[model samples]
Target: MPASIIEVPVVDPPLAAIGTSDGDEAARIQARLIELGFWVSGADGDYGLTTRQAVMAFQKYMGFNDPDGKVDEPTAAALTNMDLRPVSRANSGTLVEIDKGKQLLYFVIDGKTEWVLNASTGNGQSYTEPDQNTPGEIISGVSLTPSGLHNVNRERPEGWWEGDLGEIYRPKYFVGGVAVHGSNSIPNYPASHGCVRVSVPAMDWIWESGIMPMDSPVWVHDGA
Candidate 1:
């Protein structure tokens, strides 16, 4: 099937928060967002936090400043003309490519981004956590998601994986102490404690769909 050609009419600038007044238009926008791999269920033309979060995720994938999940004219246009294969360097094989600068995660198979999810990585700040083994002694590390190559070495199914920093939902561990897991909050910014965070629904879908199976290569790069 070919990509759908969506023609969204140009509308007046948002007088308040930007959202859909028309149910049909909202459905069309939701369809495009889901097709591009942002996790959003029930595109029954209802626009709410779920749709807004999906839009924020879409904006992150497109390397746009997503302060609000408003469906602007340009954003709608880009979604309509989305590129299936967004990442250029990883031209072959299956890999999890994370554009840290873009704050987006791409599940690539055969050079195409099967799914694009909005993610939050380390915020480059530092925090102190007491040692697991030694009491009264703390260990400190900068809250930075390391950029490089990694492989999915472990996965936790249907449970929360506790860590020194925090707990992750259904985590798929790639690097030491760093995995892509589900979270209740997936803000459109870098706010993790050195791990990558996706929405709970997105993570569940990834696991259910086997998007990041064991030994899958995960490439973290700044350039999208």
Candidate 2:
């Protein structure tokens, strides 16, 4: 070893990318997400699908370019600072606002956005599928998420219901056949058959919270 040579210690960057393993770091992240109104099934140490969805929701709400659900140094810092909370577009009353542009859902209460979740809406693409009524014939329609004010006219309280396109869990129909419902796959981008798709756990929480009840106002629009 040279006398003038000096040693430097390398340090690992701050990250909590949880997988199957359970740890306190995962639990802390989950708790913070829940506190910030990102719906996780529980604050357990396991970073499962629910926690991942919640992290994704938080990232999307914060307008991150890459919301990959990975808790990196930037995400950890943002989580520590609690000033960034989502706001509602509406002026008054409680309602559900679906921002198609952002692919997010805002649960507004008293004009304040209390909860934010990642959502997938219509992809604005034409599709052809077998008609349920007549399997031999094909049906065609554009996958469009209707914009404007609507109300919860119908809903399926529990279990999965077979829809024209696919199975929707606990659907809360607002306009025609379109509803904000639980889905198995809620990608960061808009991809749905004319429905608002949130994580299955999120949909369960929404039902339990009663945020959007029967006749509850639902406003769907592109981002500002």
Would you list the clashing residue pairs of candidate 1? none
lDDT of 1 by residue, 10-36 (tens): 333322223555476787777766655
Clashes of each: 0, 0
Where is model 2 more than 4 Å wrong at Cα?
1-21
TM-score of each: 0.80, 0.87
Candidate 2, 1-224: lDDT as tens digits: 32222232222233355543467888888777766677788888887888888788777877889888778767776676654455647657788889887888888777666778889999999999986655588879999999999999999998787777778999999999999999999988889989999988888888997888999999999987
Instruction: Supply the TM-score for candidate 1.
Output: 0.80
Model 1, residue 160: distance off in Å is 2.8
Q: What is the lDDT of every predicted structure here?
A: 0.74, 0.80
List residue ranges in candidate 1 displaced over 4 A: 1-22, 48-50, 80-85, 130-137
